[model samples]
Target: MAPSEKDARREARRRAAHRRVEPDAAPAGETAIRSDPIRVTADLTPELYRHLGRHASRAAEEMDLPRVPSVDLVRAWIRVSDDPLVWDKVIKELRRAKQ
Candidate 1:
């Protein structure tokens, strides 16, 4: 039996998702890292949310980035936190906040 229109659309979408790009297809001076990114969620106050958005926007403009996603900024912070000095500072702030 012939597939219905819905089945055809589904097959097309599946094929599109599976399509792979050539390793060298990235634009000049750009490196593409293909990896599955997992989602991380955080709870923030409305004021903090606005602050994050504004910070990301300003950084994006200053750095000539096409966009500065909040996730990217948070990931950068995580990378920085790997340093002993930054880690210590974060712990100090946490302790002070608890007092």
Candidate 2:
């Protein structure tokens, strides 16, 4: 098949085995891991003390950020956490937070 036809078929397959690669390489000194938005899952212990809504409220109040749902904060954290610089910030802030 032609190059374009192959790519089209791969895209339309809607299956992991038929994935097509697009050249969106990260720049220098950056990791290409998780370069695109993806849906990941976690089975949090719901009975645990802390939860997203409460944390989100506290973060908004302490950090003077907009009052959005805590899920947004968690999602944004996941997106940036792979970066070392941002990870450092996470470490700093988390260390400062109450354990």
Candidate 3:
């Protein structure tokens, strides 16, 4: 006895359908982390915009890591530049990076 073409097609479809269905497993006990979105608006000169993009790309490449959101990076920049203490700390860190 041989299977018909229709039966083979149906069997293949059944196997594919079964593979597509995910197994319903109970979630392991784990806490989900939550984060709030930060927003900002800014206007930049063309040169400054290019500089920011390059800085962000270099930051991303240094560790072959995920890129930080531009908003977060910009917020960080503003926070550091606005505070003398923070700027001093940043300069110290940069000096260390050079060594």
Distance from true position, residue 74, model 1, in Å?
0.4
Lowest-lDDT window of 10 residues in candidate 3?
25-34
Error of 1 at 70 (Å): 0.3
Off by over 4 Å in 1: 1-37
lDDT of each: 0.78, 0.67, 0.69
The C-alpha local distance difference test score for the whole of candidate 1 amounts to 0.78
Candidate 2, 1-99: lDDT as tens digits: 799997976665444332334356444324323345777766667753257767888878988877867668787778989999999998998999656
In model 2, pairs of residues that clash are none
Q: Candidate 1, clashing residue pairs?
A: none
TM-score for each model: 0.54, 0.37, 0.39
RMSD of 3: 16.3
Which candidate has the top score in TM-score? 1
User: Lowest summed lDDT over 10 consecutive residues: which window, candidate 2?
Assistant: 13-22
In candidate 3, which residue pairs get closer than 3 Å at backbone N, Cα or C atoms, i.e. clash?
A: none
TM-score result, candidate 2:
0.37
Reference-based TM-score, model 1: 0.54
